[model samples]
Target: MNSKKSKYHLLVLMDLSKASEAALKNAVHLAKEINGKVEVFHVKSPADVAKYENQFSAMRAIQEDTSNVQSKLMKLIREIEKEEKVVITLQISYGNAKQAIKDKIDSVKPDLVILGKRKNNLMNFLEPDITKFVLKECNANILISGEDNKFHSFDDISLGVYGETIHKEGLEIISDLKTNEEDPIRFFRIRNPNNSDKSVTTEQNKKWAVSYTFSEGENALDGLASYITGTNTQLFCIPRKQNENASWFGLSRINDLIYKLNIPVLILR
Candidate 1:
């Protein structure tokens, strides 16, 4: 299934961070490319009632908190929609952050989910392992942006091939967002001590996109990261390793790159 369709529905998670705002802008730019609609989702963590002096104070604070968060979100949505000339909607949720995000994903069933990744801390700029959970479990593909405020232009994409072969399904999904036919996706594989086969891929690979390889005696993930940085890739795409190939590169390695790489990362699921 090439899934070479016309439009898409993109859901962007917004937490009022600089990175998240960037994600929303990038998502808007992407929606323009894919002819997609955008949904800006925000999760307001419940105020700490325990910290309040009494129940009355807690109740008052909670009410104020909701109003502030909602007002800010609405303002943002309106500005982006008006400035970009794109129809966008906003969804706000309460309670647990991770659970709220998961619920939204299930309800929206979007074609793609855009979220932000800040390099300021390691625990989680969003929540505990929320990014990891979504990348591992979500059915739709995820586009993660760093603090870079510049609108992401998916002009030059770098796809990392795990083995001699690449994930065709993932490629098809990414191809749907290729608005510019002038620039083709560049797919590459790193040959090292563990996995090294100089054999060429089939003609089918050529039909999909251009292929490249890098010989690195060092770590494979590091090599892949270097290639993306050197090429000035706007977006980096990697396959979502199913259970069968989970051990190939492990998800933790991807998480470690949160603060390291500033470009948008596409975990093609």
Candidate 2:
């Protein structure tokens, strides 16, 4: 845990879309609570301009469009500033959306990158979704906001421990949260439901509130959701495996959990 990097820099990836608004609102509230700065970047693909060159001969039209995006971003900043104590910055780039975002993440070195998980469609297949790409590429932490337009507090956090790798990183991240006496950590473990004869024991030192469930259904998301809804957890923490393809302890469980749970998710890499 790096206590020296207490102050967080939050980058909100936006496109002035409805989903982006929800993400930005949640991010602004979080930034205010953490006393962090907020930056919003809108990405415009240069390929789009090239493809439309026949219809619009002037390159100035594309430049004006980029400028308009920056103006809109500033307006959003002003609106959020009225309600929260955040220093907002705006950026606009013309290139690949994912690459532009990655570049910004590298240059700004933000503590966390906030983004909205958009629906996947055929048109977006080749260009892969930015959120998914960020998960694979960026070294910085990520928070994927859902359609639910609400603010969340990390008063009660749940750690979905399945293996040693996730367990170790989860514990470290939870410790770094600096939870007060009022708030404590909660733990949950998933196992086969049919193994009634088998039992998983939790260490006493790391024990807080522990629950075990047999994942009777094939869907791992259901098992995790049962715990989340049953316990009303605020944040869910999981670890990313070093190997991208292998799933020794079911790393895909995190992806399922992310898609099902509406709350903030922490993926420790």
Top of the candidates by TM-score: 1
Per-residue lDDT, model 1, residue 23, is: 86
Where model 2 places Cα greater than 4 Å from the true spot, the runs are 1-6, 50-58, 118-128, 154-178, 191-217, 241-252
* lDDT score at residue 249, model 2, on the 0-100 scale: 36
Alpha-carbon shift of residue 85 in model 2 (angstroms):
2.5
Over 1-269, each residue of candidate 2 has an lDDT whose tens digit, in order, gives 12233366878888777667777887776665565667887787866655554646546667777777777778877877776645577877887787888899999988778876554211121254666677778987677765465655533334444322334433444554534524434544454444444333323243444544444356655766777767766666555643321342353555666777766666665
- Which residue window of length 10 is worst by lDDT in model 1? 156-165
Which residue pairs does candidate 1 place in steric collision?
A: none
What TM-scores do the predictions have?
0.81, 0.76
Best-fitting candidate, scored by lDDT: 1
Per-residue lDDT tens digits for candidate 1, residues 147-222, read 6678776543444344344466565556655545456456656544455355534234355455666664446567
Least accurate 10 contiguous residues by lDDT in model 2: 119-128
